[model samples]
Target: MRKVIFYILISWWLVACNSSVISPEMVDECPPIYPDYVGVTIPATIAPMNFSCLDGEYERVDVTVTGGKSGEVHVNDKIVLFPQDEWQSLLKENQGDSLMFTVCIKKEGKWKQYRPFPMYVSSYPIDYGVVYRKIAPGFEVYSKMGIYERDLSTFEERPLLENTMVPGMCLNCHAFNKTNPDHMSIHIRGQHGATLMQIEGECELLDTKADSILSACVYPYWHPSGKYIAYSVNNTRQSFHAVKDERVEVLDLASDVVVYHPETHELLLSPLLQKKEVFETFPVFSSDGRKLYFCSAEAKPIPEAYKEIRYNLCSIDFNPEHGTFGDRVDTLIHAAAMKKSISFPRPSYDGKYIMYTLSDYGNFSIWHKEADLWLLNLQDGTKRPIEEVNSEDTESFHNWSSNSRWFVFSSRRGDGLYTRLYLACIDEDGRVSKPFLLPQENPWEYYDRSIYSYNVPEFTNMPVELERRKVERGIVSDKRIQVKVRQ
Candidate 1:
């Protein structure tokens, strides 16, 4: 069989430092270049490491790979994921002696589970090596998962549970948080049995009045110091008729109390909170945890009037030292062009600018529908159109990377209806470059089908050394990964 062996640089070298195996440092060598953009070509008989089913039913087989490069690998049929049999493939070396190849599996006559798995071409000149890992069944269900390592070789699964929030509840705003290395938080609905669980080792309830206050909390921002979490809750009734036109409330983490719309608010008032008040939500706290930015709107009565969900971004002074949220809440940006809704306000790491989404709540279509990205300058409160980035279609649910150099947000620029992850580079002058879709072609393979979702992507700023150590020995100081509960 024709085999393609690839090489990995020493970049991924961490923990064990096995000179014989590829390390994490080699990861940078593999970029996600598409075939149309840049093709990869490998040279020589350098054999990349191999993987097969533990059953050992399929014997070791050799295949050669040619014309394959780091991000782009050419694999016709060697890469396969058959649960019943053993699978093996070869890696080839680039002219520079690097490793690169694509892997895939065939199931039910369809060529699926294909990914560009970057390999390390053994400069050691070894003919072959063994790759080992047990297959996780297709039945296991997951709530919210993020890509820690994106390239095929190092890309592994990591959970947001260390801080306790479900994927379904969070993907709307916070995809993942790089700021919090260990414990992560997610927004959940307390209305229909959905509760926010704190993920320390496992998901547990975060004991606070928030448990009883808002009907649902969508996006959560962790404080820079990791002491508190700021989130917004929808204070609407569970009735389908009531939710379509409910209001939002912002909550303070330190005291587990409702700061913006206190318990006295209309949503919390009557036999079912008989009295009524205005609605507010989408609370995003600055990195320093001093200012809390949110959106507020007057609640409407008609469901068809859902398009009336017009909320303008606003903020209040927050004092982390005394756990006191001061008054003086003011509106940052409110455009009548939104026709109604302005939500999901995300602040940059430096606290210089804010990005938010504008959409009509009535019709959620991306085509003729309109949703765009807007920026709010905190300096002089200047606002303008970011034409290079926003379009009439839809651009919402955005968050910044730790370095604040790149930001990830979901958009419907491609297939109108299907929302995909897009990464845009933030220039030094605060101008955002054109956005590109996430490299992973099938990142949304496992998600709810009916709704036009797939949002709240959180990026991690984990150190290179930390990821290297993880891939080498599969060991982490975090208790969640180390221990397993038996079924």
Candidate 2:
């Protein structure tokens, strides 16, 4: 009855879509598409790269995807949509090659075909998903926010924990050891300020503030061995601008970097990183766990001299077994010499390069319109701006994929205010590719009405399994393990 009618309708729709497409008048130029997937390389496991015509006046769009492996898919509709199973199958069959895209659009009953483009398929596989913080695009107060995990293979996102668990709480950036969820850490700020630590699948809430430190743990990065976690504690303050171009400036009155020994419940101190005149933050363990990389800027007067604060890409030796730092600090890339600043120095897991954010001045590059991405070659010590992936807008808070062949970064490129997530590829020879926006089932509609901004995107090898009920109780109960041992 109804079931047979539904099946027959579906069959007819498919046939119509498959048979109704006609040869269109060829044009010389390419179609201007949203997301601009043109010439972008993607892994086989990524979600379908669905797109639509940027000019919405079109009556319909016809897309033909053809790969060198003798695979093809056609769609004729208002917006181009590919069948998920077929898209996956085609991508899998075309690894290490490219697929051609021929887009034709019908506007007011006439059909015209644009020049074809190519979508590269990389042989390298990406991580399972990414974990990030989603918060309202404001700095004064955090009304609602959460740490979420998204499966890259699909458009599925689930929140690990939301501020609703305990209202007025803020969830800062989360970190994992080599993309393994077994070792994770997140900083919670508010009345229930604490650091949630998970080591080898065991989770605990820790009051990470100590009398000797400037403040509670803020930014976190885990050592590969899981023996130590590096953090930067800062006495931070913010100021608003009266001018038109600038809005906010985050200046650290004082900051220092330290390492935490999970097994011993101790804080490893290093005076080298705690100099009174030097402000240090954004600590990360290097690829082999033998070095710790961080950002350092000469401390300046509060808000008056904030523009002079610039951080350099620096590193210090570390002994993972001993949970200790080297005596001397090295300035890997001194931005002050060039009158520029660097922040968020993320070294590739394969130890090939360090990608960082550069601005005119100040360590808080996210608020700087001049902020852009720069790459430092580890082997030769030469550095340059990543022009291919950078835009005229701010690019901040980037992370490397587990495979080191891909990277994800936060950019305010589209409209210069709403932060969006984009992913790009960098090959072994230091060649970079144009980045594509993070995929959505319907990107145009999703981004237009979005109020929240994506920040601190991190790749995870697998989905993070956390028990929200237990965590809510832990924070509500106000019980936390002190990082410093009891007297």
lDDT per residue for candidate 1 within 1-487, as digits (tens), equals 1232222333444322422222112222222322111122211231122332121232221222332343223323222222211111333224334443443233233322223343333222211111111112121232333323232222233432221222222222332233444545433232212323233334422222333454343445665655555555543322122352232222221111133221111111111111134455666778667877767665566444445556667667777665456645676666434475666677888778888776655212222246677777888888765676676567766777666666767776654555666656665577665554443322333222323344555655442112332321211221221111111
Report backbone clashes per prediction.
61, 0
Which residue segments of model 1 deviate by more than 4 Å?
Answer: 1-178, 187-203, 207-212, 236-276, 336-340, 360-368, 441-453, 463-487
lDDT of 2 by residue, 311-375 (tens): 98899999877677788999998899999998898889998888999998878778788899999
Candidate number achieving the greatest TM-score relative to the actual structure: 2
Root-mean-square deviation of candidate 2? 2.9
Which parts of model 2 are misplaced by more than 4 Å? 1-19, 485-487
Q: What do the candidate models score in CA lDDT, each in turn?
A: 0.42, 0.88
Candidate 1: Cα lDDT at 204: 29
